[model samples]
Target: MDTLFDLDEAPATDPFDPSVSRPYDLLRHDDGADYAATVTGGGSAVVCGDAERVLAAMPAGCVRAVVTSPPYWGHRDYADPAQIGHEETVFDYIERLADLFEGVRRVLADDGSLWLNIGDSYTSGGRRTRMADRNNAARTIDFRPDTPEGMKPKDLIGVPWMLAFALRERGWYLRTEVVWNKPNGQPESVRDRPTRSHEYLFLLTKSEKYFYDVDAITGPNGRRNRSIWDINTVPLAESHDAAFPPELVYTCLSHSSERGDLVLDPFLGSGTTAMVAGSMARRFFGIELNPEYVSIITRRLAGRAAA
Candidate 1:
């Protein structure tokens, strides 16, 4: 298995920063030479131009499961000229993401499942406000840290529903919308509505019959008593400007995949998915547009390997 970081030589410019020229040059490297070596060892990865192009490189029907959080439309500036989440229109964003998933479907096994974790977005007072912005605002306002925490920033806006609908239109069967409830969510004081506290984990299947080892990934509690599952929040060593919690990655991976299965993260920002996948003894294939984040994820994965 050839990891994306096993390049022959480092590029001249940083790949992730918006200020840098030829930001995608690193992904264009001919690292396929190391693919077999890496994959055979049970943990391999490749970084490509985009999810669409990356999916092309994968062998059809090779992947058993996909547990990823694609770029939330209009969320962050990935420094790439073609940002996946920062689209000009929501319709364009949905179409773009759906297209990527279509490619994902091609590479997935017949019984594979895609556990997609995504939040929502909203327009506030004629101005578009991201859920992240609202969280930041709550923090800036000095809201009581102990107040009831609501949904992840993405849910505050509504991207999950839009994505679910889009994926459904693309022939995916919506199996379940699992709620990832954060036990230690940030405090918020919203006077207009009830405090939000959970995000959606849409489990989609290619067919009614899919390969899911639910018993292997179930929580210590051992029962799906409710759609909500409690998880802890931990900070990253070096933030990638846009990233979700590793716990989120862990939960999705454990619940949707098994050991030695390949997990694909198209928006591999900061490599949280890769890092967690590596730690859990799973194969990971990631496609990150920004080289800076590629480096960050590589360094973090290397650290985990060392640890």
Candidate 2:
């Protein structure tokens, strides 16, 4: 099988530059600065910061797989006024996300795979958001929607398709789109259309061929049982604005990566990736711009160590 590990082409770009500042690298082992403590056994590290900057710190072909969910366009506040996704036009969000993926492709092991989870956006107040116009928003939102429903973008479905197309344009292989069925998802009592429960998880490979160890990250019950996995209904110890379940992370990791491979989350909200990585014996590196979140994740990881 053709693998992502084989890179005979000349380097297209140089990420190492003195001008670019290296993001914070808090290396944590099972027995060190609880905050800097790395996960025991062989796993991956979750580095924190802009994906580009974080990728710069890592050696090329160091990561076996990347499983992450970046901030959706106009979805939530990243607490950074200048960040790309927050408060930006959909077009800008897609472009910026694509830029990050470009960097991800660079550092990713030739045989590595990227599992990205992203959802669409809808404009409030009944407006139709066009995919083409949304693209321009990232550039500039000068054009206004036609009707009130059109004024704001809603039911943002094709954004991922646009992203896939963009990545394909850059030579990244477009793989299958896996649906994350939220069996117990919060109900939405909408007057029109069905409630949105599931989201799309795009499994994109760096090259046409990549490494995938399906059995490594299998759950306690294993993959033979069923495709639908249960969502953790337990309340978090602390309040995290946006957090995904460890089960989801675990499933992705177990299937896509192996022991000792690096796992990165550029948008490390509340450090779920770090926590799961530690438990599963995988190294983790997470980046959060907000100092408060950084502290929350640090304390959470520390608490895990104490437990």
Top model by TM-score, which number?
1
**TM-scores across all candidates?**
0.74, 0.72
lDDT of 1 by residue, 171-246 (tens): 9999889897766666565667766677788889888888766664443478543466565444555756446666
When summed lDDT is taken over every stretch of 10 residues in candidate 1, the lowest stretch is 139-148
Model 2 alpha-carbon drift over 4 Å, by segment: 1-48, 125-155, 216-235
Q: Model 2: per-residue lDDT, tens digit, 1-307? A: 1211111121212122243222233232333322332232223233334556555545566566677777666545456665555533556667888887887887678888887878765554333232332312222222222322224434444667778788788878877777667666655545677877777777788887787665553435674423454443223556554577666776677777765556667677788776665565555556565666777887776565555
Choose the strongest candidate by lDDT: 1
